[model samples]
Target: MKKTILVTGASSGIGRATAKLFQSKGWNVIATMRTPEKETEFTELANVLVTKLDVLDLDTIDSALAQGIDKFGKIDVVLNNAGYGLMGTFESAKRESIIRQFGVNVQGLFDVTQKTLPHFRQNKEGMFINISSVGGRMTFPLMPLYHSTKWAVEGFSESLRWEMAQIGVKVKVIEPGGVATDFGGRSLDLQHNQEFAEYNEFVNAFMKAMAQSMNPETMTKPEQIAEVIFEAATDNSDKLRYRAGADCEQLLGARDKMSDEEFFAMQKQILGL
Candidate 1:
């Protein structure tokens, strides 16, 4: 029987690319997003089901999964790719933004995984490919909220694997470095307070450094990350993590070999702080 994969946040970027790639490879795809009505491209695909699934909405999550199982028989893999970055200073972040960062990235992922567990447990085989970030393992200047949630995801997935193994449910994390996506655009919630005059100089320097770093020509493509996700899904290994870009490999490598003070010093030097 042909396999099926369910992807969240499939309206754009990595999720969309992964959904399309899996469909092209003869896998049934449940391409889910907050507003399925706005999607036009995936509607034309043969084995793809574009549906509504806002990670923050439990009802939508349940409905989308049901819709996928109804249309494609069984879901063999689930790619939890629904998340965004909350940038800028954490002190300037609104209470709602802080709550929302954890809600969508951490709580939402937990809900989806918990909801899907029964099905996978009964089937005796399934896989979860979570979209983490290089920030999950390391840190940057202005994205404390975003990095915190990803770090939570990393720890949760790593620990969950042991229990999941008993039921043949595999858990894997994909850590991608800076990608050429709208994450720095519409997907990013930047919080800043001009009233915090003390942070102005540092914030300005950090933003300037970030702008220079986010070169699309040098960053990894969403399609390339999708390819990595596909490999993790089919590799059938006990590997718990997969880094999805050359930058990811480099940064993670440095973190692995360096001490905490050394890594922080390097980061400060790079950001010119």
Candidate 2:
């Protein structure tokens, strides 16, 4: 009678860590990724069900959920951890990048949650953990679209929580500051805008500074997020959000404690922008 959890983007980093941690805790884990075969880490784990799932693909998402339900009888939690980051100035950002960002970050998460609602309603119990970011609360230069999506998740998850309250379904959002993950590495979409070559040097320096500033240790570990997620899923509390990193704590604190001008000025000073 172990509680079952389905985690998307389970091939690497946060998603991978969350899935593994849940498995270690004896929860039945349906760990899914764009291509599960490409990831050998979860393939051999005990109590982990590796499946292929690309959040952008509707058919694949549905198939994975159906298969998970068949195997586990019920899904106690759904973790929407599948997403990537797009970095560039607003003027330099491409339409396609914006679409892709919203597609996976917002649309994909929405689709997955919608797909699982019937099951949760039927069972009268389930938790949906949506992965947002500290950027949602505070934004930096050249990350407009990325910030927009996470901000959307913040609003969306909160609204969904109220809507689901009567049915015993919980929607929780985890806002982590940059963690030690490839999300800011290989997953970062760093396209140059020759059209804005005027700002090329400035933009390049900014991007490099970002990579340098995001020291993993200064941020949170993926396990920190996993631990927080575990609490959200099992604690049965009324809390609707959890901030999972030191950077998040600082940023949220600043948001609460500082004026708009003070906050923006402090951020610019820290980022050297």
Candidate 3:
């Protein structure tokens, strides 16, 4: 029987690319997003179900899972790709943005995993592929909130692997570095307060450095990351982490080779601090 994969945040970017890639590979895809009605791309695709699933909304999570299982009979894999970055200084961040960043990136992921565990447990086998970032393992200036949540995801996924393994459920994390996605555009929430003008110069320098480093021409493509996800899904290995980009490999490799102080110094030098 053909396997089924459910992907959250399927309206765009990595989520959309992964959903389409799986579908093209003959897997049934439950492509979920907050507003399914506005999605026009996956409507006509065979074995692809575009449905509503807001990670923060438990009702939607349950409904989407039910809808997928009802149609495809079983869901063999779930890609938790619904998250965004909260950029800017933490001091300038509103309480709402802080809460929301954790809500969607960390709590929402927990909710989805908790809800899906039963199904996977019952099946005696399943896989969960979470979309983290190079930010998860390292950090840069002005994105503490985004980095914190991703770090949480990394720790959670790593720890969950042991427990999930007992139930025959596999847990994997994909750490992509600067993918060419709207993550820096529509998917990013910039927090700034006029009162915190002292941070203005620092933020400006950081942004300029980021712009140079995150050139679209150099960044990994979402489709490329999707291929990595697919490999993790089908590789049938006990590997817990898959680095998806050359940048990821380089940055994470450097991180592994350096001490904490060295890494911090390198990051500071990169931002011209």
Candidate 4:
């Protein structure tokens, strides 16, 4: 029988691409989103099972797992890809924004993983793939909220891997850098910033700089990330992290080769300040 894969936030971007790729590969793909109605197209696919799963809802997470097992009999991988980005400086971000960030990105992920652990432990084999970001490893001035959540995921995954090792469970992190997805437009929500307003001209200049630096051709495609995720899900190696995009390569390389100060300087240069 083919292996089974459960993907959260499967309505779009990397999650949708990953689900389709797995279904194409003959895996039983449980493609779940906050609203199954939104994923009418995925339900039409033969190997894909569309289920309702709002990561923020504990009951929905449980229902999704139950449905996955009922449909596929086994879940070999759980891809935690449901998250949003809060784009703005820390001082400008409201308390509610911070709460929402931790609630969805950190708490929701924790709840889902906790709910899945029992099944994986009983089966004695499974994989957990957390979709993190390059910003998790390095940080920028304006994106502190987004960076904090991802950084938390990175730390959480690393620590969880050690505990899961004895049970034949595997944990893998997919860290992608600046992909030209609707993520920038849809995922990010900006907030008030009085101090940064004086820097608005600088901000616009930086935005232009960012646009110029991002290479469309080299930008990590959703399919490319899906491929990496598929490999990570299937492989049983000791490797815990897979950097899956051009920006990831640059960031990881700088982390590996340069001193902290040097890397910071390089980031400053890139911002053209």
Query: Against the true structure, what is each candidate's TM-score?
Result: 0.99, 0.96, 0.98, 0.94
Put down candidate 1 lDDT per residue, 28-84, tens digits, no spaces.
Answer: 999999999999999998999999999898999999989999998899999999999
| Model 2 CA deviation exceeding 4 Å by range | none
Model 1 pairs in collision: none
Q: In angstroms, what RMSD does candidate 1 have relative to the true structure?
A: 0.7
Worst 10 residues of 3 by lDDT: 190-199
* Cα lDDT tens digits for candidate 3, 6-71: 999999999999999999999999999999999888999999999999998999999999999999
Q: Which has the better lDDT: candidate 2, or candidate 4?
A: 2
Pairs in clash, predicted candidate 2: none
Candidate 2 lDDT over residue span 44-81, tens digit each: 87777889888899998899999889988889999999
Worst 10 residues of 4 by lDDT: 190-199
The numbered model that scores best in TM-score is: 1
Clash count for candidate 1 is: 0
Task: Tell me which of candidates 1 and 4 scores higher on lDDT.
Answer: 1
- Global lDDT of each candidate: 0.94, 0.88, 0.94, 0.87
Once model 1 is optimally superposed onto the true structure by TM-score, how far is the C-alpha of residue 181 displaced, in angstroms? 0.5
TM-score of 4: 0.94
